[model samples]
Target: MSDFTDASTEPDANVSGATPAPEATPEAGTALDIVVLAGGISHERDVSLRSGRKVVDALAEAGHNVTLRDPDATLLPYLAEHRPDVLFPALHGSSGEDGSLLDLLAGLDVPHVGSAGAAARRAWSKPVASSLVRDAGIAVPASIVLSHESFRELGAPSVLRVVQRALVGDLVVKPASGGSAQGVTIVASPDDLPRAMVDAFTYADVAVVEQRIFGTEVAVTVVDSGDGPQALPPVEIVPTDGVYSFQARYNAGETTFFAPARLDAEVSSAVAEAAVLAHRTLGLSDLSRVDFIIDSEGRPWFLEANVVPGLTETSLVPLAIEASDRSVPEVYDALVRNAARRG
Candidate 1:
C-alpha cells in the first residue's frame, strides 16, 4: 500500500500533511513538474488524448506545472533526462491498460498514478477480474471466455451452442480487454449471439460473453487520496438507445446521468461498500471505477474495474468527484502531490 495520506476532502481546503512552498498551491508542499501521459496506439486513442488534456488543465489550474505527453520512442529517453516528479497516466485501452507502459514506468523508478503492472493486468482482463471479485464474495454475472483461434479451429457453431446452453439470458458480449465500450454488443436475441461474437472479436483476440442482468446501470468511482480507497457517489447511467456504446460514452447528450444514483440510502451504501471491496480485492492503487448492474433486488453485481478511467467532460469519474462535494482540480492536485511524495 502507498504511504501517502488523504490530503483533503473539502472542496477548497488545503492539504493537511504537507507544508506548501509559498508560491505552490495549498495542496502540495512544492510545485511539481508533472507529466500527464496520454494518446497511445490504441482503439481509444482519441478518447485518451481528450482525457490527458483535461487532466493537464486541472493540474495546471491547481498550481502544478503540468505537461501533456504522448507515448513515443522519445518518451523514455526524455523521462530519463528530466524525470518529472509524478506521472498521471491518462491512457485507456490495451495500449495503456495492458500494463506494458506501467511496467516500463516502474522499471524507470518513476512514480505514477493507478495500479501496478501486474495488478493492472488482472483488472484489465474482464474474465480474470470477474473471477477474482466473485471469489471475494461479490456477485458477478455468469460468463465465458473464448478466443478467436478457438472459435475458428474448434468450429463456431458447436462453441456457440455450448455457450448459449450454459449462460441463458440476455447477454452482453465484449472484448476481454480494451475500454470506452469500443466493441460491446448487447445480445438479447438468440440469433444475435453469432454476430455479437464477431463484433467482439474485432476489438480483441478474446471475447467475454456474460449473462446480462436487467437493473439500474451505475458507475462507482473509488479513489484513494491517502486513506484506503473510498467510493464516490454512484453515477446512474441511462442511455437513450438503451445501450451505453462508445458513441454514448464520449458524445455529449447521448446519455443522461444522475449523480448520487437516486438509490435508497441503504442500497447506495451497499453499492459503495461493494465498490471499495472490489478495489482492494483487485489490488488496485491510486484510483479505480467499478461498474455495476444493480438488480431489482438491489444487489450490485460486479461488471469490471477501470484503473485508468476516462476524465473527459462526459466521464462518470468527474461527475462522481463533483457530486462528492469536491472539485476535480483539488482532488487531482492532492493525488498528484501525494504520488510525488510516495516516490
Candidate 2:
C-alpha cells in the first residue's frame, strides 16, 4: 500500500464564463474499503500504474481504506473473497477501456467507478465513437478506417492512392482503438503515409487516417457524482515539440497546459456544452474526458472520448479539477460513494 498524501496543486483560475459544477454532497464522513486496480499487460501499463497510484493517494487522503492491486489472474478470485465496498479501476488502454474487464466485473456484481460495459464498448473504437458523436450533431474529422489485412490484400499502393484522394490535406494516422498517443503520426507529406500506417498497425489491427484539424487542442473532463454529468473546465494542450506524443503526456516538462483553455467566453461555453453532449450521447457515466480541436471559426471538432482518463500528476483531469477550485480527493471521494450507493 502506498502512503496517502495530499496531491492537490493550485492550478490557474477557471476559464472565463465557465461555470464550475456544484460541489457534490459528501457521504456522511463514512470511510469505506476501496480497491484500486492498475498495471495491466497493455502498452499503457506504466501509465496505468502511475494513474492508479495517484488515485490511491487521493482516495486515501479522502479517508478511505484504499488498496492498490494489479489486474492479474488472481484478481477475480481475490475480489470474490474480499469484496471491497467499491472498486476503482485506474486502468488504461484496452485492458481497462475495451469493456472486457468491465463486463467481467459486472458479471461478478462488482460496483466499479466508470462507464458500464456497453457504453465503454461504444467509446473504445474511434470510428464507432466518431460516428455516434457525429450523429448527435458534433463535428468529427473525416477519416478512413482500414484493417491491416485489408491494407495488405488490397495492395498498399492502391489504398494510399484512394486515401490521398479522399483526404486532401495533412493527415493524422493512429490506432483505431487505443489511447495516450501510443501509435499516432502526423503525415504532412504523401511519402510519410505508408510509414504512418505501419506505425498505427503496430498498436492495433485497425488504423484511422484522419484529416489533421489545425487549431488549439483541448481536453474536457465530465464528472457525474450523483447528479447528471457535467463538464469540467477544458485543459488546452501545448506540447513543446508540437506533437502531444506519449512522452509529452507523461513527462513533467515536455508540455505546457492551460487550464480552462484560452478561448473566449462564448467559445469556452460552447466547448463545455459540446463535451456534455458527447458524454450523454455516448451513454457514459462516472467520469470521462472528451478531446477536441477548436478551429479558427470557433467550432469544436470532436476528436475522441476517454472513459478512463489518466489521473497521474501531469494528467489533464487533475489540472481541470484544480482549475475548477476542487481538490482531487473530493472528486474521487464522491465517485466512490456514488458507486457504493449504486451497488
**93-146: candidate 1 lDDT, tens digit per residue:** 977888999999999999998899998999999999999999999999999999
Clashing pairs in 2: none
Q: Which parts of model 2 have CA positions greater than 4 angstroms off?
A: 1-28
Question: What does the lDDT come to for candidate 2?
Answer: 0.89
Q: Per-residue lDDT of 236-302 in model 2, one digit per residue for the tens?
A: 9999899999989977778888887999999999999999999999999999999999999999999
After superposition on all C-alphas, the RMSD of every candidate to the true structure, in Å, is 7.3, 7.5
Q: What is the clash count for each candidate, in the order shown?
A: 2, 0
Output the lDDT of residue 205, model 1.
96
Off by over 4 Å in 1: 1-29
What TM-score, computed on C-alpha atoms, does each candidate reach? 0.92, 0.92
Count residue pairs with overlapping backbones in model 2: 0
